[model samples]
Target chain A: MSSLQLPILWAMLCLYVGAFVLDVYQFFQSNEKVKKAAVIVTVLAVAVNGILVVLRGILIQGLPLNNGFEFGMCFALAIGIIYLILLKKFALSQIGAFIMPISIALSCWLLNLDMSVNPLNPSLRSYWLSFHVTAAVIAYGTFAISFGLAIAYLLREQGKLQKMPEAEVLDEVSYKMVFVGMPFLTIMLITGAVWAEYAWGTFWSWDPKETFALVTWLVYAIYLHIRLMRGWRGKKTAILSIIGFVAVIFTFFGVSYLLPGLHSYIS
Target chain B: MHKFLRSLASLKLAIYLLAAMAGLYAVAAVYGDMEIYSSWMFRLLMAVFWLNLFSCTVLHLPGAWRISRRKAKADFAGSGYENIAQAENCSQDEITAVLKKMGFKMDTAENEQGICIFAQKGKASLFAPHVLHLAILIIIIGAFLVSFAVSGAVICTDGQKVALPSAVAAKIGEGYEIVVEKFETVYDDQGAVDNWVTTLDLTKDGEVVASGQSMVNHPLIYKDLTIYQNSYKYHFLLSLEGVNAEADGVYSLPEDLAVDVSDDLTLIAHGLSDEEVFVHVRYKGEEQTYTLILGEPFAFKDGISMEYGGENNYTILQIKYAQGSKVVFLGFIIACLASVMFWSSRYREIYLRQAKDGAWQGRVYCKSPEIMRKMKEDFETNLRGK
Candidate 1:
């Protein structure tokens, strides 16, 4: 919490790296024990990451969700938690092989970010800040899972059509995952707009962040419509869902850093 | 009526509504940045956008109709439900027929519990889309109404009595005038402003009613009217000195000071002194002829630069007017509450059925599983643990 607790942080970092290595090994080896070991490592790393967040929050008197560094760390933790739950529920042990590495990469990226604490502005003092930001993080985490599913879906579709190892199952799982993700993304959009209206004078200010969020929402909306109305199944649906998640990534990181807007907190 | 309402609440309508909103917002973004766009026109366009978006979200009848028609067609085709027998020793035609009879238009079975069916049911899920959109529209309308119907600003100097604008005055309801008892500004050591404070007295028919001091970001509210410190500027006093003699007559000592005699010769004064011979000058528009003292400087107008002994000097102090309203604040609160309700209160249901063989089969569905996962996990874990 005091920024000098490097030992604990370093240990977490080591575990994160180990988890990534184990996940990669499981992916290639296709061993059930290796896969289970990867899941356990991921769960442990996520728990440690959760403790880091809680300690930071305790020191700050609230969650460290005020800036990009904190957001990246929190997002990584959320994704780790989500991946573990999905792995346990669907017996999707292979996903951890990919998800843990992504989580580690994000955590490393967070470490590189500026860790300075910014004083909360008067407008951000409302209780809604927690609600708004927490929802956004959860929504982003869902999209990340959807992205992974889409990639798996595309790969599986290619493999199945080529008389490969029944990758069609991957496409189904991706579709189901996206179907799960869409609603949270919708709620995230609605909540963000509401928060904007309260803090600023207007509901929609046409800020770059707002615009990109709308674009992201549209991409997913198109994905849903294609899936529902056109009966788009298989690899094609997987590809579109993946494209939707890419748009979400652009909205979250690209818009915040590359585009100028009222959401200058990230900058 | 029930059928109509159900159609209106369909998911298809929600998608259309969201798409339309995105399109309109794109248009608004383009137009909002153009200086040539009139404010009134911009406001009108915004209002139309809000109305269309809100209507689409709130009205579910059209979606219900589309879904119902799709359902009727599926029924006619005799494809409506799960064709469970298709898995074992069934021809393609027989499989298709059984699927049709089971109310499934198209079906694919993966594994034991993974059955993907394309059939139209639970049209109520469509209502979720409308719910989000309608909430947004209501927030916009509420804000717009407050902006147009009930907000105003008033400017008053120290000891000045000003009538509040009609928009705010009428709402205050008879027998009240606002008086600025005093206005003061505090500045930091760096000469930057720290804050502006205005002492106000609300009077009723020449008698003092209520009085309080309001500062920047701190508003005073009375009878649903709120006032905030908006902004301020500077006012200055000026004097002049020194004189000189010109070819026509006596002129100012400052060579730059201009004097005109019969519009032929004009004398300009450069500098003036207070105890020296000063030039007496009169302009065509002057009501009282005054002498310009030597070695002294005076401001000619509200903001005019003057030089004295190779140095420029100016004096002015600014006074600010505060503006605010309770209606806009109320709208903000409502919008926040609406957002929380819309995002947090999600309605979802999962249908699970056990096959005759006692194998567990189910579909898990929700608006936002990411947000609901903690709850879902807790339930699953607790159930399993028990």
Candidate 2:
């Protein structure tokens, strides 16, 4: 708990930098060993970050989602876990070069966070808290993955990210990421509404948080519809995916700060 | 007219409108008026979007239905299932079994060339998109019906009975009474509150129809009625007694705990506790700290004293009976299932036919060209058992 000595998050940031450097190096050169090492280091960073979160969780006797700092760390942790899962599931190439830097930036940002444990506010003391927070963090992680993959799609389509999969494969994987993430996002919204109905007397109050959440969902919903119905591919779907993640970022970060609502606890 | 209809169902127009709506949402977020969700522009865009959804789904329903019911054609002229150990010599039942495992519907019909086997997979779920859209439409309709539902809040303190008031805001009428058996507030280690919990019961016709605890994320149910612990307020009761018990008086303390019982006796609270309030009693030109048990009167001096009475804590609860919320929930479940089905990997058409050389040929097609190639690779493995 001392601010001076063991900066756990600072160490985590160093690991992030090391992983990013290795991934970028592996991307430029077709060194399988380097790729393997980068994956290992990234995994290690994630593990260390997990220790930090777990320690925080234990200190608070709850999930690390009661404040902006906690939620941000939770979101960063989600992105790391989802990234590892993607690496395991797909025969991905050096696309980690693109995603790792974002992870690094988020991890570095964690250094600035208070990281102080705050008790759950009255509004957040619900059984749905776990489900809601879990779904939201996972959804945000997948959204970040989708954004990174879309960028990879654009680059690979133009013959960049040489070792990465072709444009079509990148697009398909990104869409699949959305497929996995969208359900969790839907669950987030549903549980949020149910929780609101439980606590606020109304299910749909059109609060700023809820409204922007709907906005984000609509953006992604439109992306899904156009991709499925119109047979959209490559550039168009990739752009929409990127746009969808932007909306997600705003819903998660921007709205909390700029447009406060019944969800000020997150802010 | 053809062009107009195309425009009405236009994907380009849909995207433009959606983007415009997104812009509107940004405006709403910036201006901080969530009422924008119910604004005219929002409603208009939604109306257009709904129309687009209706036309898109209705227009596609027949095609999907037809495809679901129709025969699948696979050319045996150039390609067929040809690589299995016993594919060429395999009986129709064996082929059918493999086709079923591969998620294909098997059928055989005599043709001019020879007997043809057509297997189809995922084609029926191709219709799921339309059904998904329909479920969304149903949910919107159900949301509209929510406006007419019976909803209101009933607030009561600990061990108080609250009657379900008549609703000018609601239509449906049912007779039930609520009682707050106890209201508990839990605080964290830092003395920060965690949540307010209300132990509630519904009595109907002299029967305890339901009884349970409700908190922020939890609710109690009785028939169609839902009781939620919405909010709370703290009330402090104060009673003063003279040391001789001759100048006794009862008073309701404000939130700031300020009261002038007499010109000479001014009571101001420094802090509140369940058992007592820490107060500064300025009397006789001096100040001293005293414990004021809010409801219980204790003699402090020959002139006056005060005691803390039980708190009149009111737990606000929303008692609602939403008629179409169940339908909304059903719609949500269906939408989740249908979205999974609709956006799943494209419907596959697997064509198997017996060629002139007594060999089986197969071809696979998918709208998602990526999935087509992958499915072909997997199908090859299925055929060769490699």
Candidate 3:
């Protein structure tokens, strides 16, 4: 590795870690001013993270999505942006405290991988790949927020947390997040299928990545479907939302490495 | 009709179908090679889901459209919602102005008791759910059509002239042929391949009609067909010494491709490994394998010596006539647009009426009570100077 590359990559890691520390401190600090400071610091870290992802993209000549660490950063940036959007709807500084640790852990693990830029694989060469990854990022981002909100809903329902949005409000907002994000997931599947048809000679390859993606979609589809029923509110909806996000996590992180396929390039 | 519609349009049925799909997909993912979607059970499930969606749309869309199209009501008498709020001593016009500020379309009706004002916001949101289902139906239909569409793959070596296997070569009796004039691999400065391009020529009725280059993303469009440069294969060429002999001429061979050594004998190159090259030879329905080192000649039954000269690459092209793909794209575009429109907004209604004490009361019904509260505060701050 070059002398400058480590520092440049570590700069993003430091900022994420710094924001995570401040968020943890805010959990114990009841002072609203300190809470606001934590939010501000988290926002700064997310900004720096954004720059890191964009700068890596510029360095790599495409989106920072060709490798594991770069994709984690890209996904982290999406989650960061989605968290910020949710801050408008909920008092979610605490939620950020819950979410940033995951961000740091993933970025840390991926950053420890081979950080050098490499030539893009021939199979990864396609306009549909760009669309597929971009949509996957956005969809996973919203799913991330829905995850946080679902947890918040559960905790508040059990009276285990305080000063967040009401459990009902959190449940509804989480549903809304999924409702808004499901189309992106749909687009991701469609574009990936189309790309597979171009590259692999079939639209659905029954590959692990494609299958898990469909599994994730089915989970969210079930989440939305059961939401229409009168009795399936509160804990049922919250638990289902969490399950859906778990499927999202499995689809995004697990499938690439644990179940290798044509999409192993992303990992 | 009522009983049948009720049974067909059940949300429980939809949820059950979705759950079944989820189960099928889980099984497929765990099993790893079985395609869940192509199975008859999954297709049956999907067909039933389609019926549910269609029936749901048919049963509910007109009512949704009517709810979206109706004028906002100021009186709770029409809808039977209890008064969630009361702006006592506020004029009907003042209340209408407040609801308008809250993004409601305002209307008022003069009842026997007093003037009642009603306002609505996000009437367009009522159409979103129905539109989403309809778009999904269209997309599924399009995908179904495209799945069964006629498509074929054609493999051609470099400098070979071949007709597209799938696309009809003769359009109204005019014959056409594609000549892959050259297939070149472009490499970046690092020596990694950047992209491969295939130069193509389309001749129809003894005249050159269309010709261009095609790559992965850039496909060649000729008439009703799109020819994609899908993949490439490498073949090691064997040079012959004699001009009129099959073994004395140049022939390209890969493990999968066979070359005629004579009329009855064939030579197929297996691969080169461990300083040894392998080629499979077959004559008169008898298969035999021979090993030859690099720069060595192999003697066959007819006394023909075969030499591994060099290698050549061939491009694989897939010719497709996707008549229903455009419909799929259209469905995708519609689904995306309608989903964004549907989820981004919400429907809200406000009703204002006079109570028995000669005081006006208004109620707000919305998915968001916070927005309603903010609007109420704004109205109070505007009117009562709070």
Top DockQ model: 2
- A107 Cα displacement, candidate 2 (Å): 1.3
Q: Write the per-residue lDDT of candidate 2 for residues B94-126, one digit (tens) a residue.
A: 677777777777777665676677666787468
> Model 2: how far is B381 from its true place, Å?
2.5
- Give me the displacement of residue B103 in model 2, in angstroms: 4.1
lDDT of 1 by residue, A165-200 (tens): 245555556665565656556556555655554444
Q: Model 1 residue B311 lDDT?
A: 16
**Candidate 1 on B127-235: residue-level lDDT in tens?**
5445545545655565565444454566655677877666666666667677877776655444555566678887878887767876653545555455555544322
Residue-level lDDT tens digits of model 2 in A67-162: 777777778888888889888988775777777777777776666656655556676777777777888888888888888989999988888767
Ranking, lDDT, top scorer first = 2, 3, 1
Candidate 3 lDDT for residue B232:
83
DockQ measured for candidate 3: 0.38
**Candidates ranked, most accurate by DockQ first:** 2, 3, 1
TM-scores (chain A) of the candidates: 0.89, 0.93, 0.91
Candidate 2 vs 3: which has more TM-score: 2
List per-prediction Cα lDDT, in the order shown.
Answer: 0.55, 0.74, 0.73
Q: Given candidate 3, what's the lDDT at residue B205?
A: 64
